[model samples]
Target chain A: MTDSKDTGEAGEVKKDHGVLYIGMDFGTSRTSVSASNGVRETVYSTVGYPKDIVSMKLLKKDVLFGKDAIERRLSLKLYRPLEKGVIKMGDDADAESKANLKAARDLIGEAIRIAKPRADELVYCVIGAPAKASIHNREAIIEAAREHVDSVMLCSEPFAVAYGLDWLEDVLVVDIGAGTTDLCRMHGTMPEETDQLMFDTAGDAVDAELAKQIQDTCPGAQFTVQMIKDIKERYGFVGEAAERVVVDLPVDGKPTPFDLTDQLKTACTVLIEPILEGLRRLIATFDPEFQAKLKGRVLLAGGGSMVKGLDTAVEKAMNERLGGGKVIRIEEPVYGGSNGALKIAHDMPEDFWEQLK
Target chain B: MAGFKETLKDAVRQMSFRTSLDKLKKKGVQNVNVLGVDRIIALIEAAVHRSLKSRMVGIDRDAVAESTKAEFLRLLRSNEDLQREKSQIEQARERAEEEIDLMRRELGEKRSLLRVKLEQDAMELVTRYSGENQAIAMKVAEICRSFAESGDASVSSVEERLMELVMDVVSGEREEAEVARKALQDREVGNLQRRIKKLNDTLVTTEQRLQQASTMKQFDRGISSIYREVQGLDGSDSHAGKKRELMVDLFKANLKLQKRGKGA
Candidate 1:
């Protein structure tokens, strides 16, 4: 409903149609969105531009994202704009950095678009950022999202997970993302800088370890990082082998099967040590009475948390080291952060959204 | 303005069927020089100026340039005229489709009516002939009984033979008339069949018109949002107080970051 109309440059105007609250998980490997309109979608955090004029004409697109970017990478100059759950560009203004910035901006737009907010709707968004993200990183994210949404805010990823689950107090959240794993302790209040720990040993690290293992053991097994990521997402496990992790890789243009059970277990289990260490430090430093409570509710979330048997493996490790601890893996680990962020967007006061706008 | 430039470029590109060198070679071309769109436009402008310089005096050159500019505007106006004509053609196509639908319904109705009329005529003839034959048989039986009642064998035999001959002659004449009537009915059926065939041909022609109309372009339909108004935090939630604090903190942080960004 339009209370008043103001003529724009070409006399363009729009009604105050509605409000759309979007929650985005801006991850290193994947970006996900959840909207109030019941739209939920995820895309890999990769952007690609066609390499040359021929490719530009053939692909018929100026840019591609997610599976298309990965699948058509040979014809593209692909850029993973985000690494370690933040924009990769630094203070130095180089060509590559500027390109990365554009790619990151496009990626943010793409993520919001996939949420499918109506053109007339006012889009208010909340993004789950890494706890250790710099102020510059937060500003960049907000700036990128502003072009597509009316207003936006950033919340720590692990805390978003904790908030999503309503485990606001006495909960230890371990969010294992692709580039970084974030650990935050919830104490029914805002988590200060000291209450959160972030580390780089995460899904990408697992992918690297798996790649290394494949190189050492399965010689001549031709694979790309994209292929490795697919395999890891499909069959990555820790602690024990459910069955033999059998996958086919091409060797000199011939298909060959490799047993990757040990490799996958070894790589996936790398998350446990960092998580346990972080959990120990956070729990040790928490309030004495709540430390036991926090230890009892170790919430495991994120895409990296999808590794089969990871929860049990981490639980088993906690028993050995922390005397006794409980580990709980969230349902829908891929959308945990986004779902929480969406809730935050919905809960944020209307005045705050208007003020930001 | 950017969009308008892209539109012009697209129009130029669509008009020119440019091919790659590799494609030309595949088509058995020995060698070909490539020309880009920018160069092609430049060459056209140069050719126009060259023609004006070579064929016209100083004032005439200016006059020719103005005429060429006028011609370009005329062409653009004609293109708009063509667009209007296209819409008119589309409306005619829609009318043709409606006529086709009407014809199809008429054809079905005509076919059913022809079949029912043929069946009714056949049933009427059968009932009439059956009644006439029954009446004639009764008359012949009465004549034979009357001759027997005269009590003379030879007279009765003579009358019976004569009656048989009369009955055979009349029956033969009736068969001839029946044959003539059947021929007339066949002619009527043939005429109806011809009309049906013509209707079928027209139906096919109109169907093709419909297929042409089906190629019309479509536009995008936007999605609808779930909320008509902003839904802030629910007041009844038990954790409303705690979530409010978190929301305020998040807002404060974002406000600061944005303020700093704007300052920068």
Candidate 2:
């Protein structure tokens, strides 16, 4: 493969290999990737390994991910590797934690594999990690990604969202994910430690709250957390709902319809308070001259932003609490971080990648 | 050269195997000769020494003997390598067979799953159509009863008119629907058959690849990349300078984190 490469001034053979740049948004619920080769994919963060000999024989697979893993969960030992925006690996880890780490590693590998990078290409990747992930968590993520790519870098998730849209300066980004909501203030240069805040009141919290509400309001309605999550993803809204959120739950082995409008709104409402508070803190600490600019361009991104009327709800709250603010929901919330990470990967100089490799 | 003795001994042992006396007689080999390893080695050396003594009177006998031994050892080494390559090919062939078996099993699973899905759809359609037919019949009967009570027509006349409507209108509609349903089923079956054909084609290709691999195992070179080195920020990009600085900061942080991790 290197036989036809040109020699340099020093008479040293220089290899001429192709480069495949990949951007990964490694979130608690989903792992999304976009490659320079125009391949984009999103998979659930769930990983499953066949439980035993019989299950292995039936599945004819060593592991499964995404929809396949979710569907065949009963026959597999499932692992949601990331929780609360960080890989769940600690120093004094137990066997389950070790297994989760393995699953996380495999999930990263799978994300790269789905990008379909050429074998002879140099896979350069940039991952958008949680803003407040611990050093240990960051190391874990780097280790996992390094196994698949030639070079990798980790940037703050919310910052990536803002950068993706070229809203680098005087912009506040609120990335609401399943496990945690990350808020970062971008002021031209790289965001500092004080520019970011994280809270665990995003999508999963809504699901939990909705489950509690369903249990309280709809008696005799049987549902699991998974079913509640689906309901929230389908019908979750805040403020005045355009239509009633009615869903069916099994009762005595028969489907029964139940109204869940109030529950869904109340559940989805949990996101607003924390996000507004985060915005206030970030905007309040900004340069007084640029504070207005920052509040004026608040970018709402990530999967949780898909909740109907969420942007308007946040804008309303900001009006009431932070005087006034505009929340612009990104057109492609799910791909925002990944797309930004891809931009970052593309802009990184060759020297930086070589040093990392 | 060091393994020459071992290779020679192995060659001798491999060609010799035990057989029943009756089997040997049946093969018309009732007599056999046994040679010990040490005697065979001595006889080979003596033959070589005698041949060299007679063939080259003026030449250095010791030098020629050494050269001949080196050449023979080289041949033996190549034969050993061939033996190793043969074993590797056998293992690869076995793996290919196992892969074929696995693919066949997967194909079976897919076929059965498709069967179950189609059957479920058929049953659901039947249940839905039966309910619709029952509702239509009840509505027709109700219309006939209402007509009889109104005294606009005789009950027998209403019954005959209703039968005519059923035969002329509903049955024709049902026939068209049946044709459309059959066409839809044919489209679905055609899709599945195409998928099966694709699977069969892939199987054949994989089998061909296995044969090729067994013959020559040299072409595992992977795909090529588009660039030789990492592409930095484009010069024309307006945000190039700032983005590069941010990228550098991120790289430094990551470098420190990785170094710390390694240190730990």
Chain B TM-score by candidate, in order shown: 0.42, 0.55
Could you tell me every candidate's TM-score relative to the true structure? 0.66, 0.65
Q: Which residue pairs does candidate 1 place in steric collision?
A: none
Q: Residue A276 CA error for candidate 2 (Å)? A: 0.6
lDDT of each: 0.84, 0.84
Candidate 2 lDDT tens digits, A194-244: 999999998899989988998899999999877987888788888898988
TM-score for candidate 1, please give it: 0.66
Each model's iRMS: 6.5, 8.4
lDDT (10s digit) by residue, model 2, range B11-72: 56665676788998898996888678868866877898899899889988986777566545
Query: What's the interface RMS deviation of candidate 1?
Result: 6.5
Each model's backbone clash number: 0, 6
State candidate 1's DockQ. Answer: 0.24
Best candidate, DockQ-wise? 1
